[model samples]
Target: MNRRTDETRPARSKGREEALDHFVATVAKIDEVLGAIKAANDEHYGTHPDEVHWGHAGDAGRVLAGLKEVLDIIEGE
Candidate 1:
């Protein structure tokens, strides 16, 4: 089955565009937050990250992996 783009579709609810817009905005926000986190991580841990400084690498890795999955879905890929 073929699906038309929003521009070709008749007038309807704004949900699709709104969702896409939200996704774009959310991605930007995520980038901003992640940037700050990386900055803090680099500042505190320097080159070698220890278990004591910054965060537990394993925990952060798990959370980031989950977030990447969700983001991939939201990005339609």
Candidate 2:
């Protein structure tokens, strides 16, 4: 005989859905930063590549790094 048990049950709560929504929002924000970085890098590379340095890229890099960490946390959980 085959029967289902509690061990094979699925989560029935709004918490998971809420978490997914939050993750999607966070990812969207990260995408926005990526877009900004691409735009800034393109403009700088085309007009002032020499002026682009660690100081200029630092903020965007930091944001991307933070987003990566958040994504890792979500995936880990």
Best by TM-score: 2
Best by lDDT: 2
lDDT of each: 0.73, 0.74
Pairs that collide in candidate 1 are none
* After superposition, candidate 2 runs with Cα above 4 Å error: 1-12, 45-77
- Give the least accurate 10-residue stretch of model 2, judged by summed lDDT: 6-15
Candidate 2 C-alpha lDDT tens digits along 10-75: 553466777899999998998898898688666763546666778767865786788789779979
Residue-level lDDT tens digits of model 1 in 1-77: 89878886644447687888999999899899889878966675344444344456665677679779988998998
Instruction: Please give the lDDT score at residue 46 for candidate 1.
Output: 45
TM-score of 2: 0.47
